[model samples]
Target: MSNDQAEPETRPCGLTPKGLERQKRILDAARDVFIEQGYDNASINDIMCRAGGSLSTLYRLFGNKLGLFEAMMTQTSNRVFSAFEAVECAIKRQETPEQALKRYGHLMLERVLSPEAVGLYRLVAMDCSSERERIQSLFYEQGPKRINDKLGAYLQSQVEQGNMRIRDTEMAAYQFMEMVKGNFQLRSLMGIEISEAERELAVEQAVELFLYGATCR
Candidate 1:
């Protein structure tokens, strides 16, 4: 479809199992295309070719290329953050705040520093489209913002339990996430190899530092 074409007014919802599977296939193909070719260079036709779906179906499901990218990001973010459910369970079981944070930190590092995640970040970062703002917003809302909100909720729980002292759980969450990431994300985007030992060390240090600051005195 042309860039100027109006996006479909209605998007697919509550699809049958088959339809959902097909949609997943299309989204997976779109993710691969966007990551390999970057946003501007990627095309709907190319994605359809890889996904083996009709052009009309793709448009009906995703609305447009941007819509498809947004869906793909949302799916990917959900997958990555689903692992954090364990952290919540740990908290409910009265695990120490340090243990909970460390679990979150390790999971965050494993997912965020992944090649696919870094590729998606680079795709959004390097996008030069008229819809760049929308793309960036979608990525932030689906990815980083979700991560911060989850971690913030966890931190708030600790504060309520008198395990930590945080005036702004939101900011504290953002800070802790940044600390966990450190230079690894940048290095990954730049194609630098981060060893398993380095990732472990980074998470360990970040959790330690964050707990040191956040713990109730």
Candidate 2:
């Protein structure tokens, strides 16, 4: 299945503008196929057919089915990380912790509960168990872990400035993220649609509670 696969942890490493565009087209098409067919049932040919690209490009760019899926995960991770960077900058600007938390929480919730995200989660749930280690590793290394690292860095900054007291920023990030979601994400992932107002209220309350628990004297 290996064609021109890069290291497990890298992507978009060498794609040119035109190449990136083609790759994106392939990815968008693949996403549709994966969402429609789920992982196991989906195939590169289907993707190629839908993408209007050759198998060579997919193999050359992604390597194989797993690589393609990881690329999908990568896209989602990149989107979230972009948002995290904004939050990081806002926090660095000395925005109120509550305000920053609300912004971050809202963005995170929106991304995780998106239609595409839910579809990916459902696809993985339906059929990625046998390769859980590979898929989970890909997802974690690029998605959750990256966000956690961003959050940990931000929290460490706050702690250094005496804005918060956290023994472990990593754990704090995990706790805060979980608290932000609570049962909301679980319900959303299960096909329960949460309203925008409800999402905002939940995150607002969660951030207040999170700050109360983490704020310094």
Q: At residue 110, give the lDDT of candidate 1.
A: 88
lDDT per residue for candidate 1 within 156-178, as digits (tens), equals 89899898899999999999899
Q: What are the per-residue Cα lDDT tens digits for candidate 2 across 136-202?
A: 6776687667777777888888899899989998899888888887887679767788988888888
CA lDDT for candidate 1 = 0.85
For candidate 2, the TM-score is: 0.85
Estimate the Cα RMSD of every predicted model relative to the unseen true structure: 2.5, 4.2
Runs in model 1 deviating more than 4 A are 1-6, 9-13, 213-217
Superposed on all Cα atoms, model 2 deviates from the true structure by an RMSD in Å of 4.2
Measured with C-alpha atoms, the lDDT of residue 187 in candidate 2 is: 92
Best by lDDT: 1
Task: Point out the worst 10-residue segment of candidate 1 by lDDT.
Answer: 1-10
